[model samples]
Target: MIELLVIPANQSQRRPNWLRVKLPVGKEYASVRGLVDTHKLHTICESGNCPNMGECWGAGTATFMILGNICTRSCSFCAVSTGRPLAVDLDEPNRVANSIKLMSVKHAVITSVDRDDLKDGGSIIWAETIRAVRRESPATTMETLIPDFRGIWDNLYRVCEERPEMISHNIETVRRLTKQVRVQAKYDRSMEALHRISEFGLRTKSGIMLGLGETEPDVIETMQDLANTGVHVLTIGQYLQPSKNHHPVMDWIHPDQFAKYKEIGQQMGFKYVESGPLVRSSYHAEKHLFDQVV
Candidate 1:
């Protein structure tokens, strides 16, 4: 088991009311968990240890992680395993569709670990998953948080053609910190990926993490860069180091700071902004995106 390093609260620290969360239990939560297990589906909630897992799962929603759990790139802040990963499960799309059906999910968020070893960068699988979900649960809105595809425009083009309700590709962090935090990803490449997706006239979205030693200016600049690419949605979450071996949190950003970032993101033209300490890329994602589209 990987040990996590948590920052101790300062002397003046007073627990913020917003940090309080309901414990995971109840029929709804168990039902969702059962469906995932029954279908052999993986969720970022459990795999990446997202703080919002209880709330989201209790609400009968989850961010499905397709392709496989093991990631090709080893980002220091991520809890997903780093390895070559298993071969693509060809029946995964149908299983995801079945799980969504069982949960009666009105909206679904599909994400994946980077599969650089795949010839199409797993684009074909992404398209197939979207199609499967659509076919099984037609009313469900779809969102995909995808990899950068190593700057391969053609691969991205194929995924965008599926016409998901929203397409998110996180920049993850500021340009300077990208190297230290996201070792294998390139800042410029991620920005370009967002740009390319937007160019296809898709509803593009991206996210960034705070408390990773990034300056305010760096965040603002990164947001501006995202806006320039015509991204419609933005998420800002506090970086909680998953394990002791992961990167250390530089600072604990207060809830007020997150609110300010939300304001900035909106003022900069993001149609929707989910910004807060507990916000993950797919946190409250269904409702947030639904509010924007409907």
Candidate 2:
């Protein structure tokens, strides 16, 4: 088993001031919340308990989660539920598209839970969701934070055929901690997935979280590896432990460190880098559509 740098439970509970988030309270936030609830839609903002939920939702943008809220993989760092998901809701695509249309979202981000139980890894729903969104909201641009499809290239290509503006598959953690942090995922497989997405002619993106006991060298190496895969956009963020049963916080990475990583990522040839303590996969996603930095 891999050794972990376990912070004392009591100390891990106290987060630094930089990690604080404003409460989700505003007209836009409420409006977006209502749309999601009414459409029976799922969002990574709510499912992952993202720290930037308030800021993102208040700005009238959200990263919609399709397929279903229940995920098949139980990554130690995620707050999303893992189990036998309910049957694939075929109407999900239409509902997601309609919700996007109602929100008048100029640029939208869509992601989904892993559906390993499905033979095609849920890529069928993935493609349908993109098509539905494009049909219902003709003017909206999109970035899809997709799953690896368990290395099933045909399934991955199915979604790529729809050609969302950008395709993202998060590395989530460094190679060293892949097994512990993301139990069923492989670092090399994720890299290859990103490479394939880039080769498909769409802009590619990936993200990773710090404070999971990853060393600086591990992070820089990971960035270079991503750049080698033709990834144009990268996001770096601090990892906040989701619950007592989840991975413990190894350290509270300082803002300066995140800023430093951003600089390094930019210098390494990533066209855009959104790096900060509160950064998540889809945080400030619209900016990435045109390769803009945050």
Candidate 3:
């Protein structure tokens, strides 16, 4: 089979059919939105400009982002705002836990902005939020999408103390483009972080966005590196530039390629591989939690 890539003629890119998502409607979606707004909670669903927000929200699942809405790092490929974050909200843990209680979510996914401005890199908040959620909703499982914390093992240990079902720290991009794509994040440092998470016997998960000027071999090599770190789950998706200011989308990968990569990941020893044009880190997160096919 011959493969084809859709290279946009200009910067004003048109999305392919595979990338389109329906507008959010339905009572479940409305209820979740209301709960988030009422409780003053931040979710990656809204902050990351996730394409699956409508579908995920409509299904009553969303990735809660604690700490604050503003991120400190200026990653070229991200849509989240980059600026000074507000003072740490000490009460945020309770609010997130309470919101999860109200949502009655079976599996909750939480993420946060890079709080490098803090001394402990906000890992304390990350740990406290996990504790609060467990206290309020004992039955709800969770996965935390965390930052690198500049590879501070002491700070990363804080999150490990809680030992949520799964701990994820995204590599975001291939090693070659790490500096350009992540601004200040280091690829090897992230690999070490994943290794440490695995060292604690926790399920380690990470994700990488495609079309960031990466070659097929770059992705496969990155996958091998992640596998070496004992990451059990991996998410691969097409990179959609949030604005003209962000990194431009080089090509729209075909769905067939995504399926191929999923196969590659599984063979590479990942238990669950979520790969597609629309797949996000938290996409079908609950499924990623329990689907362990040996």
Question: lDDT score, residue 196, model 2?
Answer: 94
Clash pairs for candidate 2: none
**42-68 in candidate 1: lDDT tens per residue?**
666777766688788877667888998
| RMSD, candidate 3, Å | 2.4
In model 3, residue pairs whose N, Cα or C atoms come closer than 3 Å (at least 3 residues apart or on different chains), thus clashing, are none
TM-score of decoy 2: 0.91
Query: Worst ten-residue run, lDDT, model 1?
Result: 2-11
| Best model number under TM-score | 3
lDDT tens per residue, model 3, 1-294: 333444442653687788887787888878888877787766768767777887777765778888988999999998778999999999999999988898777788999889999999999999999999999999989999999898889999999989899999999899999988998889999999999998888888999898777777888899999999999999999888888999988877778888888999999999889999999998888777764423
Stretches > 4 Å off in candidate 3: 1-12, 25-27, 37-41, 291-294
Error of 3 at 289 (Å): 1.5
- Write one digit per residue (lDDT tens) for candidate 2, span 98-206: 8788877777899899999999999999999999998998888899889998999999999999999989999999999999999999999999999998888888999
